[model samples]
Target: MAVTVSPSRPHDTITGTPETGSQLTRIALIGNPNSGKTSLFNQLTGLNQKVGNFPGVTVDRKSGFAQLSSTRRAEIVDLPGTYSLYPKSLDEKVITDLLYDRGSAGYPDFVVVTVDASNLRRSLLLFSQLADLELPAILALNMTDVAERHGISIDIQALEQELGVPIVPMNARKGIGVAALKIVMAERLATHPVRFWEPNDELLPLVRQIRYYFNLHNDYLALHYAQQYRSISFLSVDDRQHIAELVAQSGFDATAWQAAETIARYQRINEVLLEAVTVTRTEKREPISNRIDKVLTHRVGGYAIFLGILFLLFQTIFAWAQYPMDLIDQGISALSELIQSSFAGPLVRLLTEGVLAGLGGVLIFIPQIALLFAFLAVLEETGYMARVTFLMDKLMRPFGLSGKSVVPLISGLACAVPAIMGARTIESWKDRMITIFVTPLMSCSARIPVYTVLVALVVPDRAVWGFLNLRGVALMGLYLLGVVAALGSAWVLKTLLKARERSYFIMEFPVYKWPRWKNVGITIWQKVSAFVWQAGKVIVAISILLWVLASYGPGQRQDAAEARVRAAAPAVATAVPDTTASQELERRVASVRLENSYAGLFGRGIEPVIRPLGFDWKIGIALLTSFAAREVFVGTISTIYSVGQDADLGTVQEKLRAEKDADGQLFFTPARAFSLLVFYVFAMQCMSTLAVTYRETKSWKWPLGQLVYMTGLAYVAALVVFQVLK
Candidate 1:
């Protein structure tokens, strides 16, 4: 392949850095969607990457720290991928605004342009746009292995000459050419000056004019030209209509200049390809992607497949997780008992019954939730997610959501926090808002404990189809009910907030590829760690507070109760025996302390109204305590019921079943448990979620509305469920 090399400048000088970057080498990775930009970034940054949101926006951001060599550690930031410099979505705006707004946190010292190997023409359009920006960049031809396997080869030397930047051919997926890329980077960092060149051709005048108008007196003319070309300028000719017309009559063939610029850029690219790239014609093999897609994407068959996939997920959580949950539960109780036996003080009770038990409750679900994500990541990476989205699009549109909304909805089965965050990918403002509103309805992992206890009490564990268990399916149905309610609510919101509607959806159907294990591992690590950090603290604090309130009472409460118990002791040498009378006295003493204590008073205050629906003062206390998290109901009720009995140990369901009301009738019957289940289904019982909602929406208003509306609905539903069932 022949090449054109502009004679090397005898000596090039390095440019001055921005004030803050005096001690750090800052590099940014930029490219169009599906250009292997993220893969390339993962290669460079590896395990050092971090995912965070941009300040004051919901857009996802990723940054990582890496060492370029033994002595140089550089900071790499991966900007959102965009087609052109023009901003369309809020996400694209993130990149464009940050680049132009020099006041941004860490502006890049260098940019890396990644191009897909198969689609060179479309890829070059963006490359040419970036080149005119005059930023120091290295254009890497990613996915070269795919191209080479297709008997295609790109001329690297010629492309480097034509684009005025180094061209590194590499397969990011295999780690090939990574070291070669590092060598080029090191050379650029050491010998070559950070260089941004003005295009040596006809497009220079328009670049100058646009610079004069939009940014008159600006110094970086070349970079500005590239920015405008990539930004909205190219999309609508009318955007630059006046300037374009004015330049037309000025007799410089302005339109021709821009056209010639486009033509020559491609011309040189083709000539470079003709010189360097060689195509050895070979018979293409049968694609496995289509073969697998046949059954997975069929309309009727696909629906069956999706259900099967969902069934497998639930079965694993419901059936397989029981063993670990039991072990974790036993471990928590054992640790608590050991602490209680070791010491004799309020501090021992606080540590054992409060913090340790509370933390265990939250962490116990980690295994099942992590498995759910692992399966989802595998499905998503294999490219079936797009098909799922396509199939669900029509069904979801009525609910004001897109197929993309399903990601968050499915993720909600694990936790609602990340599920809501995942909604950021939905493009339309209306659709995204709807997805966020309804995600919590999808029976999160937090609800599992409550559901397990209620289901065990109310529903029989029976079998159906071979390998299909009724209890597992019932759990799945509860999840599905939440989904149905969420979609129904969204339908109402869509009608209420009817702003505008259109069905134009633009999305990239990336080629089906195996799920990257590293990406999945990173996701699980981040989500699980953050979940523990955020919810663990709140639960622990609340548990400790409840322990204090329940353990000790004021004035004569403990004294009176202890004296009554002592009075019940059988007659010894010096004591009078009053067995039956003393037993009755002790019971009466306990009732008085429980009535006057803070939790007791609060419970009694709410008891009159709830008593009609079959809840005792103890149940009232559990309900109030559980507002921190809905699933806390099981543990709260378990503790309250256990407090009433002589036995110090038993499972939550056993305690709930044995609990009886003053009428001597069995409490927590099928009817009462069903009511409790309904209450949990719709309750606003998560403070962390409210905080996230306020943070996302930027006001206290929506979170307040959410609490009132959801809780009111839950109460009404609970009342109805109990009355009807009874």
Candidate 2:
């Protein structure tokens, strides 16, 4: 395909590309869920993409640079998917806000509406709405390949003429016709030639008044402001108030008007599709997806299959990730040993025991994190996750959660911060709040380090009945425990909270297809990198802080303690071999030095409180540090043990496994390890999760309530487990 740039835009003389400092044109990709919109965004942007929040909302913003031509480049923004302009949830409201407020940073110069070619009628509703708003949009007839396979055909030229905008039929997943789409984008196509909807005569006068007052060119845009002025943040208070008065004067019936407008748009869409689209059936047959869904979504079979899949997923995470994790653990140990031997100073200790220890603790789990995300990405791309959501709706509904809440709950398994933000898509205020309240109970990937380490220490690695890994089963049980806790909490919140608004779950099941490997790879890269970087920063800071407290004490207390330990040691006989006695004396000195340090003082202060749960001062220290992030627990324990021990360096797991109590039993006993695991599952350990909950709810009450409840629950649960198991 040949590309051409509009003459209006300037270019660099030598390379024929846009001028070095010139701003790139902004293009927005809008589509419904499962419309292949994200596939196209990935194709256009590739590795140049980033994810963030829109200006004032928590809805995700995905944007990247795309080279449309030698002289033209576009900054493509992937907006949250929505079916129509009418806002039903916070995610959908972002679409309306960005499109209506030209002053918003994310507002686009042009729109690319990704239309599912197989579902043209429903997809066109949004495209038609954009046309009425007079946004410059091009129809991306995506999923054309899938449509063709299902006996659907479309006339691209006829549809282009009917919508009065350029149409590009392409399989975004396969990169077909992308070049043609780029060529069209480089042309700076005009808005659709026809207006698809206009306010009826009764509302026309009011719409005209709004248009004139706001100096807006499109009547539909002005009408939206009139209907949604209260919620539109971009509008000035005075302007909104005036609009409110005008609406009052006109006695505007917003619901009736919106319904009438939707009916009219569909009427126009029907006429257009009648001329441009055709579906042929040689014989009556059900789709392969439907046949598969019969078993995949069956009332009882679906749940069994989901559980089986989850079991396999967790087992694979453990087995496949072990080798790489071992390599990482070994590498970090080697580096620490080299650092210790090559240098001698407080800085050296900090480098090895502080930064490296904390960083290494999180890094060793990258393989496991990547594996987890890879499985999730495959399920999502294959369109099986939607079925899971549909299947779980019945079970969740009884717990006061809608099917829509399933996405966030599942997402919480990866990270609670974003998952809490994901609750925006749940339309009901009551359901969304309930989701936010209980989502933190779902164990996240951050807890993987703590879980793996604890499980390895207590749970046997050998297979049960020569098939299932006992360790894997323990991990699954931890995750399932989190789910059960979340549901039970949700049920309790349902009873406590009162709501008059009824909740409904409406969802579409996308056709099953092979997972797109590129998309899966991107998802894995993003999730893993985010974990390492975000968690790395917090861990590094805490590691340095903990090292200072662990290394020294106030007013020479550490020196005094060491001196007392040496004085208390019995003299060894020079005539007889006493190596074991000497080593034991040295170990006693190391332990005394650490116990008197500031960190030890702090931990001892909390020991009495956590004693009932079978936690020693060391475990108490870990519990406090891990509140910043659950993964930090491993690093905290590593640093504490490293600073306190004068022995050979090893992996955190090794150090923890070798830990012993005064009575000579292992410190992390089966009862205590599982008790800690259960505590973390119920704890509000991530401050970021609390912060995000606050941002999403815009009130301190919800986050404060969540923190108090979850922490109390963790304490009680841990106490019970310790008492029962011990």
Candidate 3:
């Protein structure tokens, strides 16, 4: 067969010429999941990276720049991992789309396919398919260290000749063989000289028509187009229609053809591996992973272990992040004071009370966010996350969710935006929908600020069991409540939403390994950065707007209100000592001015609606402002409290503790605090999450329904808790 190369892309040969200009060579990194693809990508593009969306899709597209050689640099595009070109989920479909559509911006000049050296036959399935496409590609035989430990060995040169591509042995975990792989990538590319599968006479006509119509050279490529034409986004309506007509006329059986092709390809792979690979030790010694799984995966022990880990994780988040959080708070407070001292106008008040207060709230939670993601990353890198999914499958199946739902649900602890987006991995539409609907019920990092502030108000700071901190226990209790709420919500959704599609969970348990600290650090950096930058922008804007609303009124109501308070000050001075009375009078005047302000008026307008939940108008204002983001509640409270008070009044938590009703009762009583906590646990307060839900489900109906149901649940739950306790 003649290799058909695009005339415009003449550098398709094994020893292709490098680009002469500033254009970076594009390399597509493709692999199976857990094939060390992430490690290789990190090694290649240490910090030169940015994530984006695939063209016309919400699936994340992670690409980064790397200097492949002294003179050549490349943009490495990390495509979603898939076993083969046959697409399952939207993520896998991206791989098929990019490779199939040469005009796609993500299409690579060359491909680097990472494969597990120990699982050679299984991993090579995708590489073989790519080779058949005649794309210039190299095989990155990763996990060789693991293979060696397992007494599996391969002749790299022999395998390279058999596959007709360069095979670089890589222990990506140890950063081994990266240099060799870079040299190969920079200097040359290779295509499989031998085709793995040829179209039989029965399907020859269908393949030929597709090839001729699409002007394609490779038979396998033509076959893929014929099979995936309907799913292919680049194919126009006319082209898909033409292919459909051709397919109908040919009477081609796609399923049977796919089965035959897979069998044929694997048969060839078996032959090649037999010649180029060997196992030195075959004594059936159980692996260490199996031994460890015995205890970790046990029905009873596993759950205890999982809960213990969760408890430890939350405790660490509270303990480890406290110092940094306090430092950030103090620094922000100092800055606010400096602004108040430096300027003598409305701008200073806006800077201190609005902008600075909002920023402090966002920054204070960074340490906790970082620690949460770091723990998650460590779990993922060490492969325990897969075990968690496997362990949770039994519990999930009863609720009409599959093992796949566990990942997104667990990920919801970080943020629901990405967690909802992560539901794309669930192939079943019903399960995916259910997962999206319930994921926000999990308390995310955003809830940390709100929870910490509230928990401190109600829960004592002493230990519960002489070792476990009472505050930590309360925090974990809140998280458990969220999880329970999510599962309960899922059960409700299961009953309400009809299931038209079946759900299946097929997951592989990877061998346990030590966490790569670099990857962990990178994950923490990215997640925390996203939180601050994306959420911070909204917080700042809302803070400034809130300042405007709280600083002014419809007309002279605020001034008149403050004047009335001052008019009564003389009597209060006579009742108390002069200095103490003056301070109390100032405080009363500030309160009246805020109550007459626009935000206060709005808060009072809604106070009766939330009164059953034990919320007053100030808390009502916070509830409304925090709809933009849950963490914004603390900032809104801080700004509102700081509006007319001295800079030395105290932190938001202290101010909240000191707040009282006209009846001289503490405002944030335990009943009210826990009620608010429960409200936040169930409420769908995040607008961004709702927007992402709309995008993921491709319908406003689902998101709208989600908002209504969750808000209703929050209201009822909060009301019940407060009524029972009060």
TM-scores of the models, in the order given: 0.77, 0.82, 0.83
Task: Pick the TM-score winner.
Answer: 3
Candidate 3 lDDT, 311-377, residue by residue in tens: 7876787689889988998999999888788778988898898888778866776776677677878
True-vs-predicted CA distance for residue 26, candidate 2, Å: 0.4
lDDT of 2 by residue, 569-618 (tens): 67562234398776666656666666777877888998999999999998
Q: Candidate order by lDDT, highest to lowest?
A: 3, 2, 1
Clash count of each predicted structure: 6, 0, 0
- Tell me which of candidates 1 and 2 scores higher on TM-score: 2
Ranking by TM-score: 3, 2, 1
lDDT of 2: 0.80
Highest-lDDT candidate: 3
Poorly placed runs, candidate 3 (over 4 Å): 1-22, 237-241, 400-437, 443-481, 494-503, 571-579, 607-619, 628-678, 685-708, 716-726
Pitting candidate 2 against candidate 3, the one with the higher TM-score is 3
lDDT of 1 by residue, 637-672 (tens): 654553333333335667567777788878988778
Residue 237 in model 3: lDDT: 100
In TM-score terms, candidate 3 sits at: 0.83
lDDT of each: 0.67, 0.80, 0.81
